[model samples]
Target: MSSTAPDQPSPARTPQARAGHALADAVREVEHHVAAAGWDAPVRVFALVRTQAALAAEPGLADQLTPDVLAAARADDWHLTSVEQEGLPAAEDLEQLLAALSWPDAVDGVAVTVERVVLPPEAEEALPADPAEALEQLLTHPQRQDVRLAVGVLRTGATWCALRTRAHDADDAVAQGADLVPGLVAAVRATLD
Candidate 1:
């Protein structure tokens, strides 16, 4: 039996298609992390930025990459700007917003910051630890909220990011270590360049 369907056509492989596929990989990577973590975290947005001080302060990454991207930043006076937003922007809004952004000419790349929610291995999805307090908070707030695990996913389709929740009753490990998503980060830099 033939494995291929005679009537079916293969998908076109274009640069955008390639980028989209890369993005799918990136999302999958982050999703794998999210599945392991908990999925109850609130979505949070962050802006990626690099500055002379930021690079100097965080030399570990500087040491990690060959050719020293930060050195270029320092030489050319460029940095990514990070703006924190709740949830995510719609695609149209994002394109418009990105267009409006003022990026440094020589910055590595632009990436959106996002957070994924994670719960501990045994912990159940938490409710308001205190119902009355939760109720009061809900009344005061526009929407109800309580998220335990949050992973940050940048807008770069070629990227996936996961951060453990910073909320109480969550694991520090989940909230730590982001070196896993460097592939997408590098791709973002490359695209920006």
Candidate 2:
């Protein structure tokens, strides 16, 4: 007898699939942590490291993590630990900021979350060409929408993104996919290279 019905596919069992799931989970966790801090926050970056290795390097860290986190870390050798990058130097734009970032070999993956004012396509036509004026227009435009984009990428090239709009602030309303923000994914992926 077949182990699984033909119509019902089996769950992802490959190493890459597992890594993808782990990376997505890590990205969502980071996004939720940032969301809890409220909106209008600065661009936040985090390095994803293997929890098992982290624990092996510093056994005292186990005391800092919650029971759930510790349990999960113990259960999965590939579990990731998010280490926030603080004291980041100021940069003019997301592109500039990401361009200046580089991770050590120890880092398994990286994530970045940032808020942006999104304007409808029609409203974009009326905005001034100057960067500062355009931002001012976007900030005050009646049709403007605020969105927080969280993107994560592993060294193996797996990518996942989460987008939360200010209008739909609920956790369940957050959107998740591998290509939600391709530009951001590419930028974050570049840092891992």
Candidate 3:
């Protein structure tokens, strides 16, 4: 029942692909954690650091995390631990906030979770010109959909995105892919560089 050629291994079996898969797993984990806090949350940011490095830097962290966490860190060389950045300065928009960020060498990647009100293409055409009026219109648009978008990007260029619509709010309902939100992914990736 296997369609893959026996001599030539599947691309998923390659190390790069494997690392991308692991990054996706980490991104999903962070998304689920944020989702648990419910909707209407402020834009939250996280720094992705190698768990092994975190453990090496602060051995006391070992006592705080569960045994499973410790084991996971030990199992994967590239296992990442997401540390939330709190008390961030207010910015005009997500892009503005992200534009001001630059990670230290210790950080391996960055992730951001934000909620946005989206309107269908048809509804967008009739929106008001004023910024405030447009925002109010988008909020009240009949075809509006509230969405929580979580994007993560690694220094190595691996990226993953998770999108959960408020209408279909559930862990299983989240859509996960490498480029679900390309624009946001690019914004996050820019911080790494």
Candidate 4:
């Protein structure tokens, strides 16, 4: 049986919103497996973005280009980039990374994913100093630490985020049914604007 009411038409979704929602869904699907491994695991993330230069490079897409509108972009410009864990700023310094991100007028939207630690800092200190005793400590208490979360964001003015985490609250918009990483999502959105 269908859960949605038959009388209601589906709402229209913008390309950015659609991509954002899809990315979040992707994160949710991957959450469990990453969390299963113990604390402070790392995940790698990337963003897929389009630019005028890219459109101009491809002969097939060139027909749609407006030279006056996208004159600032160069053939070599690329928006898509690894977020972090590829030994880059998206992990080492997200704020700085976002400060440098912006979509050109010819760009329609952007998509990005982030892989990071979900466990609170306190969890790491709980680990025993002795390697031999660490396993025993975790096994005995079973605190369920060491979660790695991956989040995806899509934006073009409006923004939507998908996240995978040990914590999820479907009823909460803050979670957005994808996940919430608070500061990280906001930083990414700021860059897009």
Candidate 5:
């Protein structure tokens, strides 16, 4: 007897089917990272997915993402950008994840910059003691009202850090990092698996 379940319907071929197609397309993109970098290295692909998501969320960013920019980011093994440095989501989380991933002394250099962004307040609040202090110092500095933080980590042992100015709450920054970093790492791992 056939093992197929008779009650189960065949796969759909409509726009909903296109949704699966879209997922497959995304998987193919993730596969490119695995092929180029080892499956064990999650940062490379994670960064790429994050970049793509950010681009989607912010219109006009996709236009700025030229082949050269992606190539450069891939060559370095990591890239990060946002609308603004100070308030970008998950900066702290990314930093912590990179640290956990044993990112090289110089790897993960963030170059892209954006404005009017802030980290989730919870993530900012959860920062490890030392970096939290530094962030606090940056925040309370009388001259600045807002700041941006972008970072990239490469497999070649280099890191890039960037920050821009805008209004932000320190607490929110921490919260954003707390929420995003774990999810990003998990998504990359899921794709790789």
Candidate 6:
């Protein structure tokens, strides 16, 4: 008698895997909403969401803002106003801002992921000498592997925003993400009004 081999077991799904899937689904939902609303500016929305994630990673960074960064982020001007107003800085607002910035582009949706390195106090001094080296050290740290740095922004004339980062990941993304929202919101709101 011939017998077939037993079936192999499937690999277990980790929490990160599950979370990523959920996030992707959420992005899809946001896309549906934007499409239905027919809002122009898809790149703006994606950029705003990315900016939100960046600011959330580095809160209070804006307080230390300079003209150079501002010029680089002129496309995301709303962040400047939000920084000035001390707004709650919603991801949705970023989406609206994106729409405003990229008017007539028709933003259907946006999803993004970012990875960052946090500089330690000891490393701060080295930043001026060789910033890239410091960043490499932080990124390669054994303790930093599991960290997740991300920001999700959804908009349909109205916007919704959420900021999150993994524990192993440095709090940099959180602060950065927070700092970026104000300028992003201000820039977008200006166009809407």
State every prediction's TM-score relative to the real structure.
0.26, 0.90, 0.90, 0.41, 0.24, 0.28
Residue-by-residue lDDT tens digits, candidate 4, 1-193: 6555687534534444554544444444334334445345543445444444455456555455466424523432322222222444553455566676665544434434444433345765878899779656654554453334344455544444554344442323224443355666666666556
User: Model 3, range 1-193, lDDT digits (tens) per residue?
Assistant: 6788888768876656756876887889889999999999999999998888999999998998889988988987787888999878678989899998998999989889999988888889889899899988888888999999999998888999999999999999999899998999999999888
The residue ranges of model 5 lying beyond 4 angstroms of the native Cα positions read 1-13, 39-56, 65-193
* Best model per lDDT: 2
- Candidate 5 per-residue lDDT over residues 1-193, each given as its tens digit: 6555677544553433433333333333333323333222222322322343454456576578788655644443213432222323343544453344321222222222222224456655555579768577545554444443333222222233333333432322321121133333333233222
Number of backbone-clashing residue pairs for each candidate, in the order shown: 22, 0, 0, 2, 45, 41
Residue range 84-181, candidate 6, lDDT tens digits: 11222344544443453432222222343323345456655545457677567666765443222223433433333333334522222333232244
Q: Is candidate 1 or candidate 3 better by lDDT?
A: 3
Model 5 residue 43 CA deviation in Å: 7.0
**What lDDT does the true structure give each of the candidates?**
0.41, 0.91, 0.89, 0.46, 0.36, 0.38
- For model 4 the TM-score comes to 0.41
Model 4 alpha-carbon miss at residue 142, Å: 6.3
User: 2 or 6: which has the higher lDDT?
Assistant: 2
RMSD of each: 12.9, 3.1, 2.7, 10.8, 17.7, 19.5
* Model 1 stretches astray by more than 4 angstroms: 1-47, 52-82, 85-89, 92-111, 115-162, 165-171, 178-193
Residue 190 of model 5 has an lDDT of 32
Off by over 4 Å in 6: 1-105, 120-128, 140-146, 154-193
Instruction: Give the Å error, residue 116, model 3.
Output: 0.4
With candidate 1 superimposed using the best TM-score fit, by how many Å does residue 108's alpha carbon deviate from the native?
Answer: 4.3
